[model samples]
Target: MSAAQIATGEIAVGQLDLEYVVAARLTLVAHAHARGARLTVNGHVAVNDAAIRVGRVHGITRDRRGFHVHAVAMINVIEMAPERAVLDAGNTILGNTIQSNGQSGVAVCCAGVTNNLVRQNSISGNGAAGIDLVGSNGVYGVTANDPCDTDTGGNDLQNFPVLNYAFDVGGGVIVNGSLNSHANTSYRLEFFASDVCSGSGYGQGKTFLGSANVTTDGSCNANFQTLLNSPVASGQFVTATATDPNNNTSEFSACAPVIAFRLLSIKRQENDVHLMWTTLAGKTNIVQRAFSPGGSFADIGPMIILGGTGQITATYIDIGGATATNYYYRMRLGP
Candidate 1:
């Protein structure tokens, strides 16, 4: 059955498995199609084999990935935590401290939520993603799942607040927007730093991918419309194309006609900070220095937190220096 067709929340009340869920491959949806699905469980489930699997695909003909282990089962019983229901389907997980168990937190695919107003939920301990925004766009987004479950949940409500990011994020947050935003539209993705994420991947790459007049913060950057028709840097060859998961030339990873260098500052925290950042296809190499207005930077070894594979992530800890002193910093990129 399709994920969108079988998103059932018919739990066995107090019983772990009042029935049996046997399928070589299972599709995960928001809730198959149940209303008011709140997750709240504490215990163990008996999948026998692959009782509860995460990340769904129609079926892969090639050898399955190690992340996809094999098991045997008949009466697979899963018990979830209290007040925790699977977040709709198609996940684009972009939060902190997420843990994947059998069946407890969520069972997402690609494309998680957007512009979530999270506060302080421990996002790293869930069975699936603490908070994901995966979608059916497939290679169109981040991961791959059965597009069949596209009708899992509604995309209106914002999500939980995760301060840390120590778990796994198939689709790390994409900052600096991308190379293909319209003149009037703004694409923003924000995150709350914490012990889990520890300020992972901060200002690691481009905030504004296009070449033109715009504004940029350490966390975000904007691009102008005309910049899309300009020339690149002298001898600086960055392969440009209108390709992406969705082939939307005006998308985050889409290649604009040109690009320009811009700076983005980091969000200041009262305590020790954990930083993170992402690099799409066409963006200037990130140059992060600690000392302000021209000072030395902290050495982070070779590779300077690169984003070669299209998406790069980095983590750093601030010892917290005096207010008047110039902190250390550094930068790197495709240029």
Candidate 2:
């Protein structure tokens, strides 16, 4: 359908497959005037046209929710700025290919744009971020990860996952990272692979690898170790996003290359236990000690907090284990 408006009660809840070319805009007018509208735009193809847009521009009071744009191809938008291949909010944009557009491939604008889940999409070669969040002040760009995630803007300025290491493990890729945000919260992390990291070092989610769910600790910290079934080649980079329980998606995290797995070394220094390890630079490492081989390990501190720049050897001295006859020491990566 080139230009169609979904009015109230015309189509309550279903899928709208647009195989034909869309010369104009297919707007969901149901949300602009009414509320409780649920629809999905599936398998649509739009080229050299205005493409699809959801929700109205300047009416936040109107309730527009539950729209899904899935498995669609939107490319080469002929429209000028302020019009993109897909402009939406309070919806889900998943598994679509949106590229070479006038503005961002998909943009969520205005003040009240929230709970819009934009993930697992091949969005690149666009004017702005693969998914750009335009704020109430009319500012549109990539927002950096804030400490504690206290700030709020587009998508509540959700904090993206900081990837520490991603290594190709023959059949799959092992990704390790952490998210520091609201305490005692659950987040859905999505991983992606790309040939090159974006210039901003944020994201350009090219290939969706997989996803994992994690909940942060009381300290607003959550560590994750996910094995993506996708086989990423050496030198390729992996990026990820964090979506809170609120369904607000963040910008892409900094890319981490898929390299070899990290190695660790352990030794006994008289009565002290000496441990050393090395991994990707900028990784946070902690030393954990266990009484028995299979016992629960607890973090040992006072001299073992490690984080650095170059690929240097990280050492931890554990004198507390001197008295223990049987002590197992190992280093853990990430928070």
Candidate 3:
């Protein structure tokens, strides 16, 4: 059956396999089986802007995507099983916004629903998880005895954040990273630093800076900061990984190089103030000076280069500073 628009109150089908090809905003009170009826929803706006008391149940498959399921101000938006029945393998639930349901947004309670992709959708503001893998009965291989076969990856989980990119090394060699995941879920974030960007020792020969267990806030984002046991010179490569409470670990994110300069010491010599700092060899830096700690700073002189290989300690003398007056100094890696 196909339609440009369709609206109904309660739909109960008997023991027959049916396919519905809908192309417009379709509203329904419930989609269920009276005597083993199998249903498939197809077309655009398949079920949009409706108050579905019991969304869909018992062997119902939503194959045609781009469907809008919103304003559901009720219980489950899409429930997989009422009794025990395995959903079809390779069946997909894609690009649908399942939100504002009183219970879970989308629940896959049946087994045998393998190789399915639930990606690029917004699922949030529900009583439970955005997507819950439940039930143990049926031929899906995920039963009460063994429920670990469910794979819920590759989805842009709203309110459930995943690590995006590692950027910015704050507080002198300490690595600061960010992530997106479910709110209040415990996550173990591990950081690794490498000297080489690419080639032989590329992702290899990495030093474990450490790991932190961070819980996401209501916004489903986290800013984790961890100090490295050993300092990493400027231009060193850094990357991170994350593990959820279920011990499901994600692959390492793209590598980001650390760009930081350490100010070592400052000495007053007559009218000139001598400043010394450490930086990676072959790097160029600029020294700036301010009258007070929080005051605006100005560049003292031309760019200085720390030539050759390996780490290097360089010095810059501020010869124009006033005598016996306080002067603050800092160095930043040149762009």
**Strongest candidate by TM-score:** 2
Q: Quantify all predictions' global Cα lDDT against the true fold.
A: 0.28, 0.64, 0.46
Model 3 C-alpha lDDT per residue in residues 266-299, reported as the tens digit of each score: 8877778888876656656799888899999898
Residue 242, candidate 3: C-alpha displacement in angstroms = 1.1
Q: After superposing candidate 3 on the true structure, give the runs of residues whose Cα lies further than 4 Å from its correct spot.
A: 1-151, 154-172, 198-205, 231-235, 264-335
Tens-digit lDDT track for model 1 on 1-335?
Answer: 34322233333222222123333333222232323322111222212112233333332111111011112221232223222333322323222222333322322233442222222122333333333333444222112122211232123121111111111112122112222222233333222222221122111111212322233334332332222222233112121111112211111111211122222344446654434554334334444556565655554434443345333444454445334244545444532
Ranking by TM-score: 2, 3, 1
The RMSD of every model to the true structure, in order and in angstroms, is 17.8, 10.3, 17.1
For model 2, the stretches where C-alpha displacement exceeds 4 angstroms are: 1-86, 262-335
TM-score of each: 0.25, 0.59, 0.35
Cα lDDT tens digits, model 2, 175-252, are 988998898999999998888876777667778899999998888899889999988986788888889987788777
| Candidate closest to the true structure, highest lDDT | 2
**Superposed Cα RMSD, model 1:** 17.8
| Residue 255 shift from truth in candidate 2, angstroms | 1.5
- Please give the distance, in angstroms, between residue 250's alpha carbon in candidate 2 and its true position after superposition: 1.4
lDDT of 3: 0.46
Supply candidate 3's per-residue lDDT for 292. 91
